[model samples]
Structure formats: structure tokens, C-alpha cells
Target: LIKEYLPGVSILFPYRLLKTEDPLPHSWDVTSDTIAAWVAKQTSALFIKATDVDGIFGEEKVIKNILASDFSEHFDSCIDPALPEFLQKNKMECIIINGKFPERVIQAVYGRPVHCTTVKGNI
Candidate 1:
């Protein structure tokens, strides 16, 4: 168990129940932006999202860097519906790093260039 290995860790679980028809109970309609705001204000944590690709791309073209506001404009085409809406509601800086790479996680956390979708704002 995590407590047995890491005693200093504290966990917070904010559970929400969706519609009865929905099968997933743990996840709500919350957006990534909302989560980011909470992270910034509530915890001293770094928010990073790892995915299957290098980053946010438009029609096969990769967008190296984009501000939060810009992301909102292009969000409909780029983001998935299942993702929390907080990502679009708040300007949370998140990186969609590559999950396949062995060191992608470390690179993103350390500010290194990793293949992924890096969205700093709404998009």
C-alpha cells in the first residue's frame, strides 16, 4: 500500500455522481481548467497530462506552444468530450507528454522537451 511505503503522502478524494445512465462514477463533467485552478490554489503541485502523441496538433501539424486563450478557440477540435471541462474553463498549464517513452514523464517534470501536447491554457 502507498501508506506503507510513503507515510508522508496525503490523499484527497472529491467524488461526484453523474447521471444514473453513466457507468463511470469517479469522473464528473469537471474540466481540466477547473482542476488546474484548484491545483494552483489548493496544492503546490505540478500538473502534467501524458497522452499517446507528442502534443496538440492541428491537421497533422504540431503546435509547439500555445497560450491558454488560444486553446479555448481551438478546443472543440482538439479535445475529447470525456476529459474534464475544467481544462477549458480555467487556464491551466498542462502538457500532453508521450506515454510511450520511458523517460517522457521525467522529461516533462524536469522541463525538458518531450513528445506531447503542451497546452498552457484553455485548448
Candidate 2:
């Protein structure tokens, strides 16, 4: 559907097989962050990640724009266990926007303000 809608965009999907004895059997051998970092290095393109929420929140559900440097400080409380450490290792400037809003994609691509988690770090 994405290819059909956006004709010129290029997409690459890499898959890995893991043994059950491994810690994360259901997850990819590489983390999403790692893949994102590789993509950025290879293409020099902006990587935007859209999720169900506006962005990561604190215990009180406060919404704040977080820089990559702040991730380690907030990692324990903010990160989703399913996400791999490699993905979060570098501040791969990714935006965690709300996917429910269709226009959010457009806004993100156009560099507009949108609710998201921006990881700031060397890519």
C-alpha cells in the first residue's frame, strides 16, 4: 500500500532468524535503532517513526520533547522492553508521532511540528 501510494519512495526490509535459546527469539537479531542508524548512514535520509502515542511520557504522563542525550537518563522508565538496546544506543533522530492522524506523515516529511520523540545524537 505504501509503495502504491508513494511511488518514488524506496524501502528495504531485512530479516534475521534467531534461536529460541536466544534472549529475544521473537525480535530481529538487530535492533530497530540499529537498522535506523544504518539506513541514515547509507542514505542520509530523515527517519521518522510513528506510533500510537504522541511521545514517550513520564510517570505523570507529562508530554515533553526528549533529546537523544536524555534517553539514557530516562531509559529505565521510558523504553519499551521489546525494543533492542542497539536501536537506542545512538541518538538516531527519530520522531515518535501519532499514527492515528493520517496527516502526521505529511507534516513529518515536510518538517512540521508534530507530537513525537526526537532522538538527538551522532548518526
Candidate 3:
């Protein structure tokens, strides 16, 4: 249904069931893990995470690029604390942009420069 109506947009709801005894996972944790697992099977993958904010910020300014190894665990509000570790483990990269701006997302998809933060995992 999404493909027939959405044209180019693809949205996946990252959800899964677990045992009652198991602890629930955070949405971002599930998403990050899912992306990591998917990337492991593919030859290449580009993770474009669209969120409400422009990108990760430092000192109130947007950080254009940052290594996953350098990402602070304290800032889990913007991204899952597990994301950096997952990215580093998978050697994958994620481009974070504001979903409010569709043009920027399209630009990121086409490998064009845009206002976003790139989390480099190839450490």
C-alpha cells in the first residue's frame, strides 16, 4: 500500500515481539539494531535517519560530522545510546537530517551536501 501511494518514500516501523521476561527495548535501540543487522547482509547501505531536529548539536550548533567512537553516551535523547556502538561494530554510517524538510532528505539521498550531521562508523 505504501509503495502504490507514496511513490518514492519508504517508511518502516521498527517493531518486534519479545518474551515477557525480557526487558523492552527503546525505539531508537530497536531501530539502530535493525539497521545494523540489515547492513550486515548487504554489500553496502546508507542509513538516513530523519528526525524532528536538524541534527546532533554541540554547544547549540549543529555538528556536521562526528565519529561514532567519539559520540557521547550521555546524549541518548537525540539518538539511542547503543547506536554509536552498533554503528562502530558494523562499520556503517548514518546521515541525520530533519524530516520536516523533504528537499534536504532528497539531497541526502542523492549524495548532495545538505544541512545534516554525518555519524561516521568506519573507525
Best by lDDT: 3
Q: lDDT score, residue 8, model 3? A: 75
1 versus 3: better lDDT goes to: 3
Residues 17-72 of candidate 3: C-alpha lDDT, one tens digit per residue:
23332333446555554444344324365678888999888898899999989877
lDDT of 2 by residue, 69-123 (tens): 5455336533443333434464356666777886987798899876566655544
Point out the worst 10-residue segment of candidate 2 by lDDT: 16-25
Give the poorly placed runs of model 3, Cα more than 4 Å off: 1-43
State how far residue 26 of model 2 sits from its true place (Å): 14
Best-matching candidate per TM-score: 3
Candidate 3: C-alpha RMSD after superposition: 4.9
C-alpha displacement of 81 in model 1, angstroms?
6.8
TM-score of 2: 0.59
lDDT of model 1, residue 19: 34
Per-candidate TM equals: 0.57, 0.59, 0.70
Give the better candidate number (2 or 3) by TM-score: 3
lDDT by residue (1-123, candidate 1, tens digit) is: 012346776544433312332333244444443443454434556677655666777778777776655544346533444333444455456666666775988988888876666656554
lDDT of 1 at 16: 35
Q: Which ten residues in a row have the lowest lDDT in candidate 3?
A: 14-23
